[model samples]
Target: MAKQFPHITDTHRDFIARQYVFFTASAAEGARVNLSPKPTNAFRVIGDNAVAYLDRTGSSNETAAHLLADGRLTIMFCAFEGAPLILRLYGQGRVLHRDTGEYKALLTDAFGEEPLGARQIVLLDVDLVQTSCGFGVPLFDYHGERHNLDRWAEAKGEEGLAAYRLEKNARSMDGLPTGLFSEEPAEADPA
Candidate 1:
């Protein structure tokens, strides 16, 4: 059986906190649906009806682009071990670029100093919370988070990261603009 709620409850919040990974799905009108598995330990429940996650630099920026074109986003959490339950947060999402005040406040309050390679913060205004029995989800043993992303980002440094984002993340695979670089200072024209 499935149960639905208007906002996240204490039980739901607790379940979210125990999860190791979450999946996000988004799409624009004419673009292919985008689904991603995020392993970063940066998801936060800001309020009963709001949640946010730190989005790291990836090969593509589909979520931000899709959210820009179409705000609907769904985040799913399923139990890999423990009581069988699957939770889905259905909502509208917005990308808060690195320069935004809201992004800064949330980062400072919940996440402390931002991690390297973090591209933006994705905030979702959750409208519906649904939970169902996850009896089919298989159990898996836990291992520590891989530090490869951190190492790669550190090796790339700030300038390298900027160039890489400009090269790969400026647009989605569907050719929709992601606005990832919208807040960056314009380069001085080399006269």
Candidate 2:
């Protein structure tokens, strides 16, 4: 059976904090839905009705594009090592780029500092909270987070990352504009 709540209670927040991973789901009206597994450290519960996460650079910017087209977003956290439970936050999400002052302030307040490799901040204004018995969810032992992403970002440096984003992240697989880069397209690189 599933349970619903109007806001994220203290207990719910505590459960989210204990988890090591979560998943984000989003979609546009006529586009393919995206469900992405996210590390727990990247997420934060901002308030009873709000949450935010640091979105690092990835192969695609589907979430950003979908959010731009349709603000619908759902964040799910499951208990893989504890009691059998799954929590979902259904909300509207906005993608905040690092260039914005709000993004800078929020990043600092949430993480003590701006994390390297952070491409955008996904802020959610949660309206509905749901929990279900995740009896079928298998338990897995916790190991540790991979350092490969950080290492790759460090090697890319700032200028390299900017160019890469402009090239690869400006559009989604569905041809929806992600607005990740500038409105004007950059010059194409020679193959």
Candidate 3:
């Protein structure tokens, strides 16, 4: 049975905070569905109905593009330890780019512009929340986090990172507009 909305309580937020990794899924109205795992502490609760995450530079930019077309975004946080729980936040998402006003407002003083490049501010307006058994998840020992991605971004710096996005993320793998690292989205001219 699906747990209905407004039934999820505050204790669920506590479960979310305890998660070290989560998965994000998104898709446009007419594009390939995107599902990826995020293993960093990139998300946080900002309100009873809203949450946000720092979108770092990555190989793909499907989430940003998908938000532009359709705001539907699903974030799943599984308790990989201690207890068994799979919490899914079903909601709409808005993408705030580095040049966008919302990005400045959401990230101001919340983080430092160091060690990595800032891509976008993804804010989710929760419409529903569900929790289920996560007994099938494999149990892995907590060792340590590898800083390779951070170090790679640091070494490349922001300028290089922008170029990387331009080269790899300007378009979706399905040849759809990604709207990332592009001077102007080619879709502007629908000719």
Candidate 4:
């Protein structure tokens, strides 16, 4: 059975903090839905009705594109080791680019430090919170965080990363502009 709440409770926040990974889902009206698994350490609960996560550089910027087109977003967390619960946050999300003052403030206030390969911040104004019994979710043992992304980012450097973002992360697979590289025109074929 599932239960719904208007805001995230302390218990809910605790559950979220213990999770190792979460999933984000978004979509534009005419575009394919995007679902991505993200590390838990990158997420933070700002308030009972708000949450934010550091968006790392990826092959595609589908989440940013989808949010720009439509603000709808869903974030889900499941207990993979101890409790049997699945929690979800439903809200409108917006992307805060690294160039923005708000991003800098949030980087300092919320995240404590800017992470390597951090491209943008995704902030969600949550309207609904839900929890369900995740009886079927299997428990997995925790190992360690992967350092590959950090290594890749360090190797690319700032100029290379900016160029790569312009070349690759500026558009979604469905041809929607992500606004990552605002100086460049949106490419029809983001190949």
The C-alpha RMSD of each candidate to the native structure, in angstroms, is 4.6, 4.9, 2.6, 4.0
- lDDT of each residue in 66-124, candidate 1, tens digit only: 99999999999999999999999999999999988988998998789999999999999
Point out where model 1 deviates above 4 Å: 183-191
Error of 4 at 149 (Å): 0.3
lDDT of all predictions: 0.93, 0.92, 0.79, 0.93
- The worst-scoring run of ten residues by lDDT in candidate 3 lies at 109-118
Clashing pairs in 3: none
Residue 85, model 2, lDDT: 97
- Over 155-177, each residue of candidate 3 has an lDDT whose tens digit, in order, gives 99878998898887777777666
Q: Candidate 2's residue-wise lDDT over 112-189, tens digit each?
A: 676667899999999999999999999999999989989998998888888788877888889888978777467799
Supply candidate 1's per-residue lDDT for 105: 91
Q: Candidate 2: what lDDT?
A: 0.92
Worst lDDT run of 10 residues, candidate 2, spans 109-118
Cα lDDT tens digits, model 4, 26-102, are: 99999999999999999999999999999998888999999999999999999989979999999999999999999
